[model samples]
Target chain A: MNSITTPSYAVHFNQIAYTELNKHLSQSKYSKIFILVDENTHNYCLPTFLAQINEDYDFEIIEIEEGEVNKNIHTCTQVWEVLSELDADRKSAMINLGGGVVTDLGGFVASCFKRGIDFINVPTTLLSMVDASVGGKTGVDLGPLKNQIGVINQPQMVLIVPEFLKTLNERQLQSGFAEMLKHGLIRDAAYWESLKAVLDFENIADFIYTSVTIKNEVVLQDPTEQNLRKILNYGHTLGHAIESYFLESPKHDLLLHGEAISIGMILEGYLSFKLTGLPESELNDIKASFLARYKKTTFTKTDIDTILTLLKFDKKNSHGNVNFVLLKNIGECAIDIKVPEDLLKEAFEFYAE
Target chain B: MNSITTPSYAVHFNQIAYTELNKHLSQSKYSKIFILVDENTHNYCLPTFLAQINEDYDFEIIEIEEGEVNKNIHTCTQVWEVLSELDADRKSAMINLGGGVVTDLGGFVASCFKRGIDFINVPTTLLSMVDASVGGKTGVDLGPLKNQIGVINQPQMVLIVPEFLKTLNERQLQSGFAEMLKHGLIRDAAYWESLKAVLDFENIADFIYTSVTIKNEVVLQDPTEQNLRKILNYGHTLGHAIESYFLESPKHDLLLHGEAISIGMILEGYLSFKLTGLPESELNDIKASFLARYKKTTFTKTDIDTILTLLKFDKKNSHGNVNFVLLKNIGECAIDIKVPEDLLKEAFEFYAE
Candidate 1:
């Protein structure tokens, strides 16, 4: 497949990814190469990743625990100290070879280690490849808050080897599919329609490539998420709050990022219908598409209130207002709209239905 | 005094500093204003800083404990949680009002909080004003390693108020003077000659301004320290190792940053004479000037060996080689020169003299 160009770096796919990666490794005078992986990727993905690197430089694998709970500064500190202990210098390059947690935390680790070092993202999960792969956003969660501490530092390159998706289970694959579904909802209705069909995990390369293209286009226009980029947060406002709530609550089962956001897209879709002139027919389509793939999640009134409280901490919020990107249509979004509290509760009811 | 313009921001001095700052505050629609200080600054500098901000905004003070020992990632985590808990959003602006610890740590905090927010540096200490003010080098140290974790992100502006210098003692003033002397040693003999005279702490504004200009010029030429910027690290290689050694060791009196680097300049001066052809007469001149201001200290063979081990962790090291910036003459220098382990021990002996 063809490589997608971002302002600072490129995303190369499949067989071409290895070529580009090896070329970059051989050309840059990296003192040492440190591959960052989590427990899952270290066992399942590292072997396949190791075979592709043609460089003769010294390679070291730095592994951390998997999951969002482990994605915090404390983990970053451990990785940083490890990098320091192993004598990783500014000239040393890091390859983040796992899901979002590893890539996000590792990118932050490299960016702040000795005031920034070069890193490449070899995203191992479907969710990471589609969403985290493009944007220069690299950060870890702060307590219950997600991506609260990070910088908008770009990587040297991103290698998306779809074959790595073989390591993911059905639920994990569906988690990444949610973002691909979002790309169609926010910017491309036709793409959204195509994504509703039952997807073969073996043939997901094209969909992943297209999803990245949509995200990259939005990110390129507003790299810092100033105005135009707010559209990308269509489902994320409530999605993130829900994600944080599930992540922290001992009583609830942990929701995968995509799973929570899938619920978010439905809730926000209802908000769009009421507030942003999103047609009721389009809202029904969005709701149906997500619910088919994701199991319907019911939030208690108390759970709804707690999740609403978390919205104030959203990064996109400005001047004490929780801003939402509601859709005017399936392929179009209205940025920075505030919905009333009662309406937010109503949207939760719509999702519960 | 005229405002000095950096590529991205300006260094406004004295009355103009307040005017520029107030103007920035009034003009930008920051959601809230956060002033970060240490315990010392919160008590000593905050009231003075608060009186100067003529804008009406909801102000929040986030104070950390004072000292170089507290400049670490753990401290940063605490500050990050505080910002989050306080509802510091992307639109919120932070004013770092204190010495290098506050400015460096606060800048890192602001830079990473919600993927960076606008921050201004109000450096209080002489060392911070001369060294940390203009470089955009913001970070916290990692376990015994000085500035091992940081990013080269500039603040919105730097407000250099000479009046704040009155808060420092003689040792602190001498500590800042070391960097000013370094400016002259690496780039300007004329400036070096001018700085050799006994300076009045009360009348050091012009000297501070010139020092910033000298440092800014080097940074602008090579912002990322790719080549020409390496010249700025002339005394820092050995200086940082010495600083880290003194910082971590309980047996030694805590050496101020400038105090340790001043010793570094003298030690590197000897190495320069041996390896880089720094004239013996000039080397003696460098030695006499620093010795008159700083107390001479003796290091045992074992202490020297421990410091040598710390050199491997210096940010400037690349490809397992410890690089030093050595002076070829009073105003000229060589960069990336490797000193033999034996020569390093000899330089410590030279300092002992």
Candidate 2:
């Protein structure tokens, strides 16, 4: 409640995680409260969340239909119209209890409502709790593009209760794990080795903490993603294009955030091997590990070609060059590495192995 | 062309007026450039704007269709799509050139694109150059309602070239003049009277400086509009509802911003007489003078009833209470004055004179 306490938000994570809903929420300083749940969260997560929170305080429920496709300006307007209808005033606070789709878009909706209102994030999916919830970057994505439009606004607090991750499917977990792996690879060799053993969800708490810690520390310094933070985007360059490309095809399964990112890491890793002197055998070791864990989704040469086209248009590509975050060995990354067009196909081929 | 050393931007009557714009903008030092313009501005204002700028910089022009009806999340999406297409990067700067509609919506789009690229605002319309442009408030209006979604982001610099006023019709100029009057009523007394004679389109440099001076001082003290600065909403409390109601009707031409505020001033002035014992003669004089300059649009009892009903849903009003900004005196205003529904009706009747 004391927002000025300078985001000692870490101290409250456990309190947020384990405390009985009634004991803490009844004492919450918010005058009026609401929960923002996307369609998926409304169906899958809100019922449980509703059960836990005490009914002592006045509360409202706002639900938006879920999915990455809905993360557009039109959806944001619908959410705003609902907020306006509900008489959401400055004193009102929203608890966004959903995945990255809801958390990111809902945070942006709340941020723009009357020049902003305080909101708390309870990221439901592993993708959101560990990744999207930490950075305070919130907005719906532009059409077919990932995070094309948004604002940077930190929430009052992010309530990370991993109990919600139990609802995430196996594909979702694998997808989320990719970013956890990415966080470690970009900055911490020791953290990477420790996480390399996190094969199942049983030991997720440690992985989440480490991943969020890496993200939080980077955000604390750069906040704006000017220099050091760009390293956090290690695998997302081609990963996003691949994700968007797949989303366009009706036959393709919806890839979770981590799944797309996992492929991104492997592709970027291959580029790293070719451009930087990352040993070919070590690259194989990295590819084998992900390939063994994630069932390979074969992309036709044409699918990859479409993705490559999008990569050229990526926001990361400064000055019209396809800039990449390439790995130096396994633990390091160098920003702004330009990779040629044909080599992209070679990297994907290398990643397939 | 040194931006920082650009000569003072102000309207001088018998006083000096100054505000810093380049000071904050120079810190950004962008690489590429972008300008957002509405259809009206693309034709009327952009030529003059391009002429004034340094010819060396390459720029991209993004134009949106005009009208308050297009101001929404959809419009923002189109603008984002354009920015993304142009390969706008972190170093890209956007110039929002047009009216309140353009400044507010353009500012929001720039703030969200790539999680906020730096943007400067060049307000061509009077309402924006003085009111919407200065507050760092940016977002689109919702449907027939007023500003329903928005963010607070100061532009790198707000370029106020009164030359754009030449393109404004009398109705548009009257719309913008309301804020100038509100600025005077809330902050300075002598400046308000001088404006009755000094409002010459030919000699507007001094007037622009005067308006910007009061706004800049208030914004400098409270960049976020937390306290004393809100007094600038004196007439706007009911004026906006009146404006929204009229805008939704077929008779929008009859009711402009200054005209609506003139009515709001009369009604609130009557409320002020009841609430703060403001001399009745001063209230009469105020109403007469504003009416002398601003042609009045007659609202039937039913129209007043509809506006009052709409007022119940205003973002500024809470708990089903109308929060009227009442004048304590000629140059003083107070916020959060809860008036009885009956007294509000009575206040309207008092203005029937």
lDDT of 1 at B120: 93
Q: How do the residues B1-353 of candidate 1 rate in per-residue lDDT, one tens digit apiece?
A: 88888899999999999999889999897988999988888888888888987867799988899999999999999988988888889899999999999999999999999999999999999889888988799999999999999998899999999888888888888998999999999999999999998467789999999999999999999888878889888778888999899888889999998888899999999999999999999999999999999999878777888999999999889888998888989999888888889999888888777
Per-residue alpha-carbon lDDT of candidate 2 for residues A121-233, written as tens digits (9 for 90 to 100): 88888888678867788977676778877788988777777778888888788878888888877888787777777768965875787677778888788877777778888
Q: Give candidate 1 regions above 4 Å deviation.
A: none
lDDT value for candidate 1?
A: 0.91
Candidate 1 colliding pairs: none
Model-by-model lDDT, in order? 0.91, 0.75
- Across all candidates, the chain A TM-score values are 0.98, 0.91
Write model 2 residue lDDT over B273-301, tens digit each, in one string: 89877788878877887877777666788
TM for every model, in the order presented, reads: 0.99, 0.92
**Native contacts matched by each model:** 0.92, 0.62
